[model samples]
Target: MNPVRKRRLVITLLILGAVAVATALSIFALQRNMTYLYSPSEVDAGKAPAAHPFRLGGIVKEGSVHRVPDTLTTEFVITDRFQSIPVTYTGILPDLFRVGQSTITTGSMVNGRFVATKVLAKHDATYMPPQVAQAIAKAKEAHRIPKAAQGGGAP
Candidate 1:
């Protein structure tokens, strides 16, 4: 090959390699920062990542909210009607956070309990996060179906 052509080929290959490396690094960073949402039942069934932070979505179980006197730490149970997970938060909770309200908490499971880093509550009585709604709907549907129909019985 001519000297000029060889140099051009090398430069093009270097540019392509750099682009590929940049793309791979971008993907890795995004994946590390991404957190997935899971329902109470999914967490109960061990579907949520045990070591990574994730969002837990469901209704706050009625009468489950508890706060330590003179402290910001609060504990509550989040339920999808079929299953429940206990969550603890140490920061100032949202004004809308209350029993029977839909909420999503970002945290990681520690010793079978969710230790939340942040908590988000629905802005209105009629509004729920789409992911939370879908998760609850799926749990409800699964509860309505019988074990036999769900292929859980003996053949």
Candidate 2:
């Protein structure tokens, strides 16, 4: 084997190795930042991560919003029309936050309650965040009645 060719092959291998290491590190960093989104039903089923922060999306349950006077803390329940999860936030809420509103809150679950660090409310009646809409749709599909159960049997 020629000396020049041997050195060229070594350099090529080093470049490829560096690329692989960089790609692996990039993915690891991104995983730390990635937050999974879950619906109320999923949370009820114990599918939410115990310690890691995640996004919870659904409609704010009617008459569930509670505020403590002279404090920034608030509590509410979010429901996908199938199940509900209580959420607590100790910060100023968005002006758009209200009962019967579609919302997405980011935080971790603790003792059966979601401790939210950020709460995002839908801006308009006709518009829901895409993730929240998808979660609600999924929950509805999961709980839909079967055709046979609905008395639509085959002929």
Candidate 3:
């Protein structure tokens, strides 16, 4: 082969290889950092990862909040009206956090309860996280469909 052609081919191969490697690394890093969102019902149905951190979203159940005296620790139950999951947090909660409000907690499941490291509350009465809203919509749609027609209802 001519030396000029051979050199050009080698350079092209090197550039392509570098790009492939960079793309692969970026994809792996993103996969590692991504966390999923799940509702209380999904968590209850074993859809959430137990060890990896994930975002849990639902409305705070009324009369389910308990705070420790003179401490930041608090316990509450979040619900989607169909299922509820208890959550524990020891950090400062957002000022908007309260019963009957929508919230998203980032944490891992331990001993049947979610241990949250960060808590996020909706900023306005009408605001809700998009993932949470989507999950709620899916739940509502599932319930609206007849069980027989779904093939998993009454048999």
User: TM-score of each candidate?
Assistant: 0.57, 0.56, 0.57
Candidate 3 C-alpha lDDT tens digits along 19-120: 999999998889835644789988889878776889999999999999988998999998999999899999888988998889999998888898999999
Would you list the C-alpha lDDT of every candidate in the order shown? 0.87, 0.85, 0.87
Model 1 lDDT tens row, 28-141: 889835645789988888878887899999999998999988998999999999999999999988888888888999999888899999999976546678888888778667
Q: Give a tens-digit lDDT track for model 2, residues 101-132.
A: 88999998888889999999876546668888
Model 1, backbone clash pairs (residues 3+ apart or across chains), number: 0
Kindly provide the TM-score of model 1 when superposed on the true structure, using C-alpha atoms. Answer: 0.57
Q: Rank order by lDDT, top first?
A: 1, 3, 2
| Ranking 2 against 3 by TM-score, winner | 3
Give the range where candidate 3 is weakest over 10 consecutive residues by summed lDDT.
Answer: 146-155
Off by over 4 Å in 2: 1-36, 124-155
